[model samples]
Structure formats: structure tokens, C-alpha cells
Target: MRIGIADTTFARYDMGAAAIDELKKNASDLKIIRRTVPGVKDLPVASKKLIEEEGCEIVMALGMPGPMEKDKMCAHEASTGLIRAQLMTNTHILEVFVHEDEEEDPKELKKLADNRAREHAQNLIKMMFHPRLMEKEAGKGMREGKEDVGPL
Candidate 1:
């Protein structure tokens, strides 16, 4: 399958590269296409192009919104646009975002973003080829610092 990486340029760190690396490591046989947007608000259009024009079955939209009021609003708008694009194209765009204010320390935030990116890469794989895995883990909380709630 063809996958698209629609990442933003406004991120202070290289979350996109991290996500792409995870995807490559997990799904080496899949075709990967990349398009960088100026900011999170630009992800929808880039994702649309990747899906509608480039024939990508799925898109991984990566960005890190800064610790500002406008940053949240911009992320919301981009998410709304992504929903619209998904409905129009009948494809999935997995929006991966890490808010700068979510952590007090820079190192913590970077680690969080990196972990989220890798988790979403696994999520992308589950979405495409293994819905059963998603269903089995639905509504399960993280009990011991682990992301999953164990197998069904």
C-alpha cells in the first residue's frame, strides 16, 4: 500500500523523521511518500493532495503545536479539514500532534512526541490490515505505563 507522510515545518524538532523511521521499520514493503507543509494548518491540503492526487491509501499528518492559544486553534482547524478530506476521499489521515505545553521539560516533551509518533505508526498498521487489534484494545486504559491493555 501507498502511505503519505504529511508533516509540518513549524515543529522545533524532527517528529516527522521519527514517524517516518518508525513506519519504515515496521512496514518496509509499503511505498512511502512525503510532503512537508509550512505549519499544522496546512496538513489538510497536503493530505488531500497525497490521497486524491497521489493515490495514497492513508496519510500520517505529523506536527507539534506550540504553547500558545492560536496553536490549539490552528490544530483544531487542521483536524477539521482532515476530517473533511477523509470523508471526501474515503481515506484515513492519522493526525499525530504533540502540544508543547503538555510537558514542563523540553526533554520530556521530545520523548513524548517520539513515543506518540511510534505508537501512531503501529496504529497506522492496525488501521490498514488489522482492525481486530484495534477492536480488542478499545476502551482499555493504560494500567502500568504501558499503552495497551493486554491481548483479548
Candidate 2:
């Protein structure tokens, strides 16, 4: 499958790189396409181009929004556009974001971003080929590097 990855250059960490590495390791045959934008707000446009122009089957819109309230707002706005893009293209765009405020420690935040990115890559794999794999995790939070948490 042709997978699209869109990330923000303004992020404090390289979450997109992390996601891409995981995807390559897990599924070497996947044709991975990437776009690096300036910030979270730019991800949707990049995603649209990836889907409409590049012919990617699915897109992963990865970002690490800062702790600022404005950062969260921008993330939400980008997600809305991403959703619309998915509808317009009749494709899936996984909106994966790990906010800086999610963890108190910087190291912890990095770990969270890495975990989230890797998890999203796995999700993409399941969505494309082995959909039954997703059903196994249905209603469960599969937190990477941590034991599976029961459904909330």
C-alpha cells in the first residue's frame, strides 16, 4: 500500500521520523510518501496533496503541539481540515498528535510522541490489510511500550 506521512517542521521532536522508521521496519514493502510542513496547521494541506496528487491510499498526519492553548487550537483546526480531506478523497487520514502538556517531563513527552507515532503506524497497517487485527484492539487503548489498558 502507498502510505502518506505528513509532519510539522516546527515540532520540538521528530515524531514523523519515528513513525516512518517503525512503518519501514514493520512493513518493508509499503511505498511510504512524506511531506514536512511548517506547523500543525499546515498538515491538512500537505495531506490533501498527498492524497489527491500523490495517490497515497492512507495518510498519517503526525504533530506534536506545544503546551500553549493556541497550540491546541491549531491542532484542532488542522484535524477538522484533515477530516474534511478524508471525506473529499474517500481515504483515511489518521490524526496523531501528542501535546507537550500531556506529560510533565520533557523526556516523558518525547516517549509519548514516539509511542503515539509508532502506534499510529501499526494502526495504518491494520487498516490497510489485516483489518481483523484492528478488531482485536477494538475498545482497548493500545499504548505502545505499555501493557494494553482496558477500555475506558
Candidate 3:
């Protein structure tokens, strides 16, 4: 399985470019997928450019959670817009994290997170199937025969 991580983890650890180098070394077989930093508010324009320039196979945008009472509505609107724009580029997914606040009930928060994930998936499917965004490149690669592998 390919392992991937969001850029937030890198920023959190203050590892900067060193983290990307480490991931590349340890998980050479895994694809390095780029994701925006949470709470940054602005879309990660520079990060996206770097990911594309570096030839990372996948990218995702991080969407913020709404305030306590308006979590669902805020997430829906923010995520929908982010996903739409990210899809225009090479990003295949958007990662949304549940807010970790002491005031909210854990069970209720989990439920809301699950619902948001499902909604995001549905939106992605709808966008990917649109005529302009069709996965023709993916289909072409599948049509070409795969190379035979010798004994592992």
C-alpha cells in the first residue's frame, strides 16, 4: 500500500524539506501526496506549484471545520469550493479534519466527520465524471500492456 501524509505534519514538526526527503527515502515505493495546511485559510498556491514541479502523483487540499454550532454547514460550503478548485488541478482528494474542542461531544463530532467524508466523496465522483475532467489519461495507461514481473 502507498503511504501518504498531509503537509501539516511536516509543518507541525518543523522538518521542512528534510521531511520530504525522509519520506522519499523510507517510502520510495509510496507516492508522496501533497496537501494544504489546515487553518491557513488561503489555498496553498506555492505548495501546489512545488508538488507539481516535483512530480508528486497526488495532492489534496485541507478544509477547515466550521465553528461549534455551525460545523456541518461551514464544512459543506468550504469543502465544496475547495474541492472544486483543487480538482481543476491534479488533486484527487480533499482531507477534512474534525475540530478538536473540549466543548463538543466526542460521539457527535465523530458522526459529523463521517457524514462530511461521505459528502466529499460524492462530490468528487460527480466532478471527476464531468466531460471536461474525464479520466482519459488514466484509461490510456490501462490500455497499454503492463510489464511482466519476475519472481519477487
lDDT of 1 by residue, 1-152 (tens): 99999998898777778878988887768988999989999999999999988999999998888889999999899889989989999899998888888788888888888888888888888888898997886777632112556545
Candidate lDDT values, in order: 0.85, 0.87, 0.41
Per-residue CA lDDT of model 2 for 40-114, tens digit only, reads: 889988999999999999999998888888998998898899999989899999998888888898888888888
RMSD of 2: 1.6
Off by over 4 Å in 1: 142-152
- lDDT tens digits by residue: candidate 3, 1-152: 22223434312222223334544543435555544454423334533453455554443343334455665565565556556545665565445344444227756555444444344333333343343543433343221011224322
Give all TM-scores, in the order shown.
0.90, 0.93, 0.37
**Regions more than 4 Å wrong, model 3:** 1-28, 31-40, 43-47, 62-77, 99-152
| Candidate 1 collision pairs | none
Q: What is the lDDT of residue 46 in candidate 3?
A: 32
Q: Could you arrange the candidates by TM-score from highest to lowest?
A: 2, 1, 3
Backbone Cα, N, C clashes tallied per candidate: 0, 0, 0
Off by over 4 Å in 2: 143-148
Best by TM-score: 2
